[model samples]
Target: MTVLPNNLVFRSITGPEELELFNRLPYVQNDELADDLARGRRRPSWMWMALDGDRLLARLSWWCRPQDDAPFLLDLIDVDDSAHDVDRCAVAEQLLRTANAALFPDGVPVAQGTPPPEFLRFVPADWRADESTRRMVEDRVRAVERSGAVPLVERLRYEWFAGYPVPRPSDRLRFRGIESTEDILGLMARALDGTLDAHDRLDLQERSAEEVAAANFADEFANYDTPRTWWRVATLPDGEPVGFVIPARNAYHPIIAYIAVLPEHRGHGYIDDLLAEGTRVLAEEGVPNIRAATDVGNVPMAKAFERAGYDTISAVVNLTWEK
Candidate 1:
């Protein structure tokens, strides 16, 4: 446990028994905290808090895949917004700095083979337009920046409910189950050309498109325990490849995990068809809702989701040690 100036106690929760104490500052992930801990997606050591004696001042935590041993995303961080007596931002910054030093003394974990986990915060879609929300969000961002991180990207999150209209499957393109890993990886690599997605762009900068495709396939898509038959490849009626979509349930939600249009076919409204096919697959499963996210700058994809009856429910801010 690290103690800050002014007698602020900084340390991780000792165990699940301290969850009630850890949850003093409310956030969206609170509902899943218990389940996440039980399922091994979170661990007590990964959750830290700053306190003034018995009062919670700031908290931080990281999350990861159930099968993984290390944290993958720093999804939760909060400062007591109502506490006016303390520099809440400084408290948060100190909490992040201390936790990260203990968690990653070697700069980056060799097991993860990337930079430290990025920070994620969820906020209203109009986070910037509202003064109070903007202030709160920027405070956390500034605190994170002071801990040696920078804003990476903002993404627009979307959700489609059961009552919403799912676009009809395309007549111009036929959808078929994925034939083989190699085939789909080839398609994914080709789709990376001139990509607008920030995550994809980041990978492309460090690795070949094919390398990124194979890595993503192994790290993300292949890790899904969901049925692979739900994955689909879109092709012209003449059997020429157009695009593909992977409609699957993730740990948290039924999602259109990925949908991409090949660079050559991008401008012809084919993305709408691809998204609809993915949505149709998940909708047929009778899910209550299907959630997805795209980089905020990817306006075309955002419009496609909006066109397909998915509501722009919220936005996600991602911060990383590197740009």
Candidate 2:
């Protein structure tokens, strides 16, 4: 049996020390991300690293579910900054080939970017997003292309933060917590007619708009640690619904789940209140920080996030694979 380079040991680990080492690297190291893996919310077969003796050198990961053998998702990948003497690309390739050797033995592995599912609903209808995600979209393409497969779609990322906060909403708005899915979905269905969600866009293309709305509810909004009661719906004192904000924890962070208003309600600034209430709810939950992202061009919604005190954490570039 031919082994990998003797000097460098490549494998997966469940040890705290190794996990700590992986979390300390630059560029792709995220404590929350590492936490997800360590918590068994994500699996280790999809995560791997390259070590030289006791010193760490290169790393690669696939972000996928535990039930699957081939990790269609790729996560963090890094090389020791000081390893200038070693070919980084070679090590990266080795890591890719190593994973592909087993998980995708019968065919090539092609990767594209898909933002974590929870975020899709928040972007606006006209925003042209771009992800250009580094490893999953970029590295995956290079890795598979080397094996003769190709990526088929554009993996794009977009962002807005404190630098572009929306102005405070008009005084005509009052905020209230949501208690029922029926109420939330009503606002969402109307919002979807003008939303930027790619999945909904694809779904509505094939399924009835009503069915798309129902599936969207089950897939995204229905599951949350913070109840829909924490959601803030903006409305007129007379009871006309304007917009709403979801400050709830999905499978991961406290997210701005959905923020939308009727067309007639646009331009009056109900979003700021909605955004503020959402962030405040998450901050109260005791998480050190919250994460939210919006479309690059959803001027109004993007502005609301800024006004509400959330900062731009990072840009997540998303791409998807082809069948």
Candidate 3:
């Protein structure tokens, strides 16, 4: 428990009896909370809130995959929107610092996902042009920063709907099902050589590229609820591998789990072909929407998603705290 100003108290939910109290905060949907609890992605002890005489002032929660003993990310942090900016920031910073210290004493790296751009649009006009919304977002970010977290990268979330016009397949490359885990792992290694992925780049600072690639492979495979047959490798006429794509369903929806262009084949514009094949796979399955995300700074990949007719639905900001 944490002691706060004015006799405020910070504590975790004791059990299922506090579900309504946990869901009372804005931002998270009640149904989503119920689903997460039912699936074991969330636990009562992982949800913490700061209260001033039963009034919720701030809250933070961690989410993990089903059956995981430890949380993988801190996905939600909310402060009362009506509070003064300074007060809101103070509550947020204190809540995060104290909760993190208690929940992650070993200093595990925890990640935070900002609400998607569309979700943040409380008013109808463009959110980017909305000053009030922008300031509120910045304040939330600063609060996280005050807790010693750093911005890892900004990401673009894209969605392809059933009715959208999918790009015609490019004849420059041919696609085939992934033949073996070893071959896919090999391509993953090659994909990291000159990767533009911010997370991959950050990991490379202290670990070998191969080690980082292996870690990524394991993490990604763990979340894939769909069949491995959905994975594909793109190649040229001479049977040279150009790239690979993992079009699979995650815990919730169909997603382009991973897509990459080989370092040697990157500049040749083979990514568009890979994107097309990945989209076609999900589109052919009649999925209502296919979601994918790329680092905001990865212009080429972002352009490829756009060229494939995926809409830029939102932007996700990731803040990380590492031991």
Candidates in order have lDDT scores of: 0.90, 0.58, 0.77
**Residues 204-292, model 2: lDDT tens digits:** 67777667767777756765556667788888899788878776666655566666776667766666666666666655656555666
All candidates: CA RMSD in angstroms?
A: 2.2, 7.0, 4.8
Q: Where does candidate 1 clash, by residue pair?
A: none
| Model 3 bad stretches (over 4 Å) | 1-5, 28-31, 105-128
Candidate 3's residue-wise lDDT over 1-323, tens digit each?
A: 22246777889988767777776667734557777877888888788988887788888777787645677667777777776533788887888777877876654433343221111111212345778867766767788888667777878888889999876677988888888877888888889998889889988888987788788877777457688888889999888999999999877789999999999887888888888888888888889999999887899999999888888877776777653
By lDDT: ranked, best first: 1, 3, 2
At residue 302, what lDDT does model 1 achieve?
95
lDDT of 1: 0.90
Tell me the spans in candidate 1 whose CA falls farther than 4 Å from its real position. 1-5, 111-113
Candidate 2 weakest ten by summed lDDT: 115-124
Backbone clashes, each candidate: 0, 16, 0
Highest lDDT: give the candidate number: 1
lDDT of 1 by residue, 1-323 (tens): 22245788889999899999999999988989988999899999999999899999999999998657788899999998888777778889999888988888876744546778888999999999989899999989999989778888999999999988878765899989988999899999999999998888988998999999998898899899889998999999899999999999988999999999999998899999999989888888899999999999999999999899999999999998873
